[model samples]
Target chain A: MKAIVVERGENTPSLIETPVPEPADGEALVRTLRVGIDGTDFEVLNGNHGGFPAGDDHQIIGHEAVGVVEDPNGTGLENGQLVVPTVRRPPEGSNEYFERGEPDMAPPGTYLERGIDGAHGFMSEYFTSPEEYLVTIPDEFAETGILVEPMSNTVKALEHAFASRSMFDWSPETALVLGNGPLGLLTLAMLDQTVERSYCLGRRDRPDPTIDIIDELGATYVDSRETPVSEIADVHEPVDFVYEATGYAKHAFETVEALAPNGVGVLLGIPEDWTFDIDGGRLHREIVLENKVILGSVNSHLRHFESAKESLARVPDWFTDDIITDVFSPINAEQALSSGNNRIKTVIEFDTR
Target chain B: MKAIVVERGENTPSLIETPVPEPADGEALVRTLRVGIDGTDFEVLNGNHGGFPAGDDHQIIGHEAVGVVEDPNGTGLENGQLVVPTVRRPPEGSNEYFERGEPDMAPPGTYLERGIDGAHGFMSEYFTSPEEYLVTIPDEFAETGILVEPMSNTVKALEHAFASRSMFDWSPETALVLGNGPLGLLTLAMLDQTVERSYCLGRRDRPDPTIDIIDELGATYVDSRETPVSEIADVHEPVDFVYEATGYAKHAFETVEALAPNGVGVLLGIPEDWTFDIDGGRLHREIVLENKVILGSVNSHLRHFESAKESLARVPDWFTDDIITDVFSPINAEQALSSGNNRIKTVIEFDTR
Candidate 1:
């Protein structure tokens, strides 16, 4: 078997040969089909984010994967079933977060993400996972099921953001997505179905494909260089909802001002340590006086994965083709991890039917 | 009719003889009984917060009042009914926030808060209000109903906080109140009925009345000088719900770290402009990775006033006596406004039974 691994403090991933293992009780042996790469993958490669598996010099770094079940191992799944694995697993026996079936709510030390933290990933020729960690999708979605993992996170973030406004009759008219990356585009696509008007803010100019995708999705494209997020309400209109994916520390603060009264901002970005000056009083006063809500969301629960399957099922086929900008084989895994091209979503192809 | 009014930039309230107001159609003339004083009143007096009524040099300043209807100009209320008035009124006809019956969600410019901003307050011996703004209570509540106005803000804040967690099975076992002023003590008293363990943080040491009240309420009192808010999770257990009433700007950021996993912080304090340094990346990452929620709430709606009447009805009579420490006549309005004495709650008596 061959796997892609990132050694400690390395900026590039390497292909290595490893022995295939049999599935244990309550586990399924899966033949990897495809794995998606995003910002988190780049962070893992740089060794600035995610933890290495205990006592290991390197970690297999892929969390968004779609695989075919080779062995159900007495679980509910069947042989040759199409499945997508969820990322986080409990550190040990049941704690509160997992016992209640909400590993998404688990804090830092209580859980580990496969391929990203304290656990090996599925970017390999063969992988084994507990049957409970796998979600089955229709066989027709073999090309797009790999997106179920990232889409699940979007599902959870949007769900929580809407839930926060459940107390009031919150009908948002406009929405702003603070990034134009793959996740941001996916979020924009999802919002496009409901919000009357939507805008996608990014650094890309007219030459980029993401800007065109934004236009194609029926959303206005606002370049960050031309109008900063804080000035969006002045240049454009105050948004009723803001989906933050840039992980730029300042966007978190500016999101406060960008929102209209009774609006909510859902944050999904994770950034590195950086200190800066801020008008703490003005921000505090704005939120308190305007009835604003800012919520932080990361990872997803099984329910969200199920919901993501339904959401992905609704996405048009042309979108899947337009967003997946790069696909590489194991020999070019490093290039797949560090592509400098204007890419939206990059993936590693592990096996064919 | 006599009223207590604060001129712009004045730190002291003055007792002035104003003309008695008459009730118009859809309006009610009320004889004010008792009016409570809190931090917002102080802010208005100092001219650092709140706005003056249009074209007015001074603003009458009391929003927390219990009164008797002297003249019901034909909406619903009968003469001599005991009532408490809500604070906010829409600027003009039909805004989205008011049309949906949610004046609390109105932004700063959309509405005016009586006594605090852009409207004459209830501090006068005689006041006029639209019938819809009055919430009737039991006659027995006249002595304690003055607390209803401030308590309504608490009801709204807590309601929004709980609503934010409605997406999950959020059964919080621990709670922390970040200030020990009247609002904080009132909040602690409210949480005492549900949360198993509660703590109130303040700057007071031994012999302070608030500390005694906190202890009497069966909640631990934490001195801010000893254990900073950011260290609460280390010295004590991380709080699952944080009620922030301290206007100190830094507590807003410290609150991010003070929360437990899947915790929520509802901010009610309004601070002044102050620039400070903060690790923005750390705060952003902490919120995202921990599934924390921070919501800002101010003012209260009509429904919140109705709910607060029920909450105040359940409070023990002894608490009303213990909380209201000082009562002064209109001749001593300045003394009532600037009592240097140690006090929990103060009131200005405008009429006797």
Candidate 2:
């Protein structure tokens, strides 16, 4: 088996030959199909994100991947079934925080590419994960299974935004999405069905096809480089909801300012540093007094995964092949990652069968 | 009528003779009885708090006061009834955010001594207020009516804490109140029924009677000047809820660190500066993994006033006249303001009848 592994913190990932992972009891050996690159992957490479365990060395790194069940160790998953594995894997013999049906609250352990000394990742021909971590992908969704991770994250953000407050009837009067990256566009797409109007802000101005898709979904596009986000409300009435996906601290402050009174701001992007200089006086006077909410959403929950699956059930009809800008073979992983091809989403294709 | 007036920003308040106010439609003329001093009053006196509408020279300088209704114009208030007036009054002919039943959401207006040109305050022999602003006080709660303002503010803080998240069931947990001022002690008293254990932190030695009351309520006291709060937590477990009443930015940071996982840090005390450096790394980690909450709480809602009235109704039975401290006549208002007698709560008893 061959996989992409990071030698150390702040180092480029390299493809190397590795032994095929074996399925233990209650675990599955997944033969890789596609792996996706995300901001979390970048953080893992830089040793910035807290998702990984301590004392890092050479390790497998990809978490967002779709694979086939090569072996299920009698855990009920049949061979040849497509699945997505959970990124977090709590250490064995840890407290019940992990075993008590809440893996998110569990202490850090051997996360793929994050921990687990010399572990092989899904980018390889074969990888192993706990059977509980695998979610079966429907046959119709296999082609675009790489999107499940990012879409599930968007679902989690929406769930957190709605859960923070009382269950009020949702009226998407207006929404302002504060980025045009892959995650940001997906956020706009997810919100397209809910909000009456949507605005997309991005850096590029070449009328990217993604922006065209957003426009086709009936959202207005504003090039952030040319227009100020603070003036968004002035241009398009006050935004009722703001989705901040820029992962930039300045955009976080500006998004809060753009939201209308009693609006909700959902923070999904994880920046390198957590320092954000918000206008506390303005936030206290306007955001709080106006009944607005600023909430954070990190990773996907089980329910969000289910919701994302349901949301993605329609992707086949809506997303054209061009939406997936680039696809690489497992051998060309470095070129796939470093290519500045205005790629919205790229995938690493593997053939383990 | 005689009143205390500030001519301009940073001007010293002076006793001045003014004409008695007459009740307008839906308004009332109240014979001022008791006035309570607040930190906001200090800010207005120094002309440092921005957003105050009153100019330096002609504004009356009090907000928290109890009075007798001399006349009511069809607002269902009977003459001679005791009432506490709401300091916030919206501008004329404007249906502001507050007028829509969101008092805290209301824009800046003539707020007692902070705004309102040439408006006589409760510091005067007589003053006028809207009928809606008057909160009727039961006859039994008259002696402690002046404390209602401060107590109501505490109630608002409690409300904000509860409103932020349903992360914890407060009844079975421990709470830490940082600061031993009147607000802090009052907050302890309020939480006595809600939390199982209370910890009071302060600098005072030779324990005061309030400390005795705290002890009587089964609360542990920590002298912060002599002992670090982190050490206290080691002895009696981390607090599930922390009320920061020290009015210092550094204390806010410390209180946040002292909170247990899934804890709520309520910032009830207001610091002068809006800009302050907090460790975003710590806050983000706490917020993300531990599910901790930090929220600001100020002023009071109508519900808080009602709760305060209900709670203070039993004060006379639970407390003694000694806790009432000194009662100075309105003529000695300046002396009362300057006394700094370590009084828990001092009231100006007006004789206007």
Candidate 3:
């Protein structure tokens, strides 16, 4: 099978022939259909993430993918069914993976190119994963099933936002999302049901159509270049909920400042450094005086993925194929990564036929 | 009337004779009883607080205080009534102290000594304030009314905690208090009704009776000097609610790190510097995986002060007068500030009679 392999760290991925995986017990062999490219994929290719090793070695590159089952190993998964697989495969029986005595591991070497010893990815003709990691896609999601992974992440963040208030009786009336990237835009979409007023903050000329989707979703847009966030917050009557997705430390501080007295700030972005300087005094004052909340969110859970799959079934109507500026065959993976167009999302289409 | 006055910036406060203030309409002349020393007072004394003008001399020390009304100008304030006044006193309909429409800005001039243009403070024989600021004490509370101010602050912190979750149905099963100061200890006492299990983190051998009271209140003590916080958290199963009252940034970060997934970390302590470092990745991961909340709190509302008065009415039974380590006449204000004993709370007992 032809696959995009990262031969060395900080090097462009190359097209190479690799052995196609077979279905093991409780696993399904999936023929690749569409694989999405994300920032994490770029990082993995550069050997910059904790999940991957420091030096670049041969690794397949893709986690956000959708494929049709070619063969099933008695896992009740039907052949020809489309599915999305889990990204992280923790060691089995470890307390870190499962809390309720469930098989929650993503299956060994299943994260496509990004796990312990990069496994062959769906950015090729075929890949195999455990039944537990695969969520069947609805027939209506055929056009946009590849977005399940990223959409599931947005779902995870929203779930965190909702869960933080699980013991409380209220929902956020207004939410401010501090970025207009793909994830941030998807966050805007996910929050449409929960937040009455949503604000998306971004640069002035980023041509990602998510901005249009944000406006279509009825969220206000704040161009960070033209207007200060403080002034925007003033007009918005102070945000009750803020989603920090800019991945910038300064935006994290500003999100806290932009919150209402008892507001909740959800930190979703991963800043480069472990250390971040925030206004501790102001945050302390807010906590004591107004009861403000600052929270953080990371990856998606299985439940989030399930809900995201259900949510993604409706994405084609909200966002069409036009949003995907370009699609490269697995052979042209380097070109897909190098093309710096203002595309909302890029996907690699494998010629399984 | 004898009072300690700051004549100019960076000048030591000197005892001097000043004319007794007469009660104007809607005002009360309170014969000073006791003043509690705090870091804020220390900042004010050193001319470091931005709230006061540095060059403008003739300022008075003390904000946390209790006294007896010698004269009442209407407003139904009774003479000889023991009371604690709210520190902020802004004129109605004035934006000088508060923003015109914002409730948070409605009250201004939190500095009792610096509020009315170098006004004399309750750290004197006599002090005058508006009747609206005075909170009446029960007849049984005269001897220990001095604690009403600090206790009220605890009430505010608790109120902020409760109000921040008012939108949600959250009732914390476990709570952690990250300080052993008077306010931190008082917060532990106040949390008795809300939290099931409480933990207080502080230094070992810090002789404050609040330790005993905290134990009495059913809270476990974790000596930061002896036990690493992570080990403590491993034993305690992660805190559901964390109150950071240590006024240390590092403590705040550690407290947040020790919180359970989906737990609330409330910032109540204000460090001197506004800057603090936080682990953004950990925070983001916690928020995403567990849906945790980080909250901030500050001074209380009028309702919180009223609750403090009610709580103080019962303090004699729970907290002994021994918490008041030393009592000084207004003339010895400098001596009270210099004493480095584990003074839980020091009160300046004015020779009001």
Candidate 2 per-residue lDDT over residues A1-353, each given as its tens digit: 88887666445678888678677888888888888887666655665444333454566777778888888778889988989876655555545544554454332242223222234346677888887778888976666777787788778667655544432233558888888777877777788778888998987766577787777778888887677887787776778788878766556556656877556777665554465454454544454334455555555545556677787775545663656778888788778767465687787888734
Q: Write the per-residue lDDT of candidate 1 for residues A1-353, one digit (tens) a residue.
A: 99999987677898999888688999999999999998888878878556788888888989999999998889999998999999999896768888888889888888988998889999999899998899999998787888899899999999999988888888989999999999999888888776999999999767889998998889999999999999999999999999999999899989998999889999999987889999999888888988899999999989999999999988888888999989999889988887667888998998785
Candidate order by TM-score, decreasing, is: 1, 2, 3
DockQ of each: 0.81, 0.17, 0.25
**Where's the lowest-lDDT run of ten residues in candidate 1 chain A?**
A42-51
Could you arrange the candidates by lDDT from highest to lowest?
Answer: 1, 3, 2
Best by lDDT: 1
Q: Comparing candidate 1 with candidate 2, which one achieves the higher TM-score?
A: 1
lDDT of 1 by residue, B1-353 (tens): 99999987678998888899888899999999999998888888988555788898889999999999999978799999999999988886759888888988888778888998789899999899999899999999888898888889999998998888877778899999999999998888888887999999999768988888898889999999999999999999999999999988888888888898888999998888999999999999899988899999999989889998888877777777889999989999888887566788998998776
Model 1 chain B poorest ten-residue lDDT run: B42-51
List TM-score (chain A only) for every prediction.
0.97, 0.90, 0.88
lDDT by candidate, in order shown: 0.89, 0.66, 0.67
Error of 3 at A143 (Å): 2.4
lDDT of 3 by residue, A194-293 (tens): 7788899988664557667777889988888886666666766688888887776666657666876556777766656456767666556555455566
lDDT for position A106 in model 2: 38
Q: What are the per-residue Cα lDDT tens digits for candidate 3 across B83-123?
A: 88766544434453233212232212432233223344566
